[model samples]
Target: MPDIYRALGDSTRRRILSMLKQGNKTQKEIVDAFDISQPAIKKHLTILLEERMISERLNGKYRIYSLNLSILQTAYQEMLHYIGELLDEQLISLKNYVEKGEFRDEDD
Candidate 1:
């Protein structure tokens, strides 16, 4: 989805996603993983949450962040669909060229 793409467009967000992929992490743990300020990390996490790319659960007073794998799966499916469409068009063009006898093989 566009939201996912927008959220992933930033390197910081992408890195955060990679970090979450390893396992869920607390806000402090996430902040420690990066050289960025805690506020900046929180901002990235907020965007990821808004895009549904990540989810948060409260563990007592701590907030644990985890990757929303389903959201990523959806994005992967969309990409596959787009690639299929492109391949279909190319195949159709090849078919047309062959029917017109315009596609001559080098071996021929």
Candidate 2:
């Protein structure tokens, strides 16, 4: 999870992941899509690969990258769980405040 957050922290890497989500793309295709140098793109790809956000395979001499849907799905689920916990905490606080009669009408 920490790895996921780290990988997603970079805008370049995020764009790389987004591009891969459309479909598998060759290293050249990815490099061409970005304005940065090939080496720069390669570095971003490396981080994404390390985080398991994307997978790569050799198609002949070219390296093709694709999104790892399972990992993204896991990340999505984890985010939902964290959000639910936060909402639950807020709701409990609200309930307690209401029960304590913290809110009062001006006429009261």
Candidate 3:
């Protein structure tokens, strides 16, 4: 799932995934939607494909890519774990601050 996360870490790749989430698209179709070159889009697609986040199929002369939802569950679980840990730490700090009366009420 590291690969999936890494691939998605880029803004461009994330945008591509957002588009894919709407529906399947050919590499050409994906490129046409943006001002970037076809090769650039293909590179992003390659990363997503390598990470198993998307799958491609050959149709005639066109290669179509579709989102793979299977890996999403694992990725989501990993992200959830990290977020939970962060929240836990922050909550503990907030509790300690409250106990010390370090925070002032909004009214003054």
Q: For candidate 1, give the lDDT.
A: 0.90
Better model by TM-score: candidate 2 vs candidate 3:
2
Stretches of candidate 1 above 4 Å error? 97-108
- Whole-model lDDT per candidate: 0.90, 0.90, 0.87
The regions of model 2 sitting more than 4 angstroms off are: none
User: Cα RMSD (Å) per model?
Assistant: 2.4, 1.7, 2.7
Model 1 TM-score, 2 decimals: 0.79
- In the predicted model 1, the residue pairs found to clash are none
Name the best candidate (by lDDT). Answer: 1
Backbone clash pairs for candidate 2 read: none
Query: TM-score winner among the candidates?
Result: 2
Per residue, candidate 3 scores C-alpha lDDT tens digits across 8-89 of 7898889888999999998888998888888888898888888888899999999998888878778778789898999999
lDDT of 1 by residue, 2-52 (tens): 366788899999998899889999999999989999999999999999888
User: What would you estimate as the lDDT of candidate 3?
Assistant: 0.87
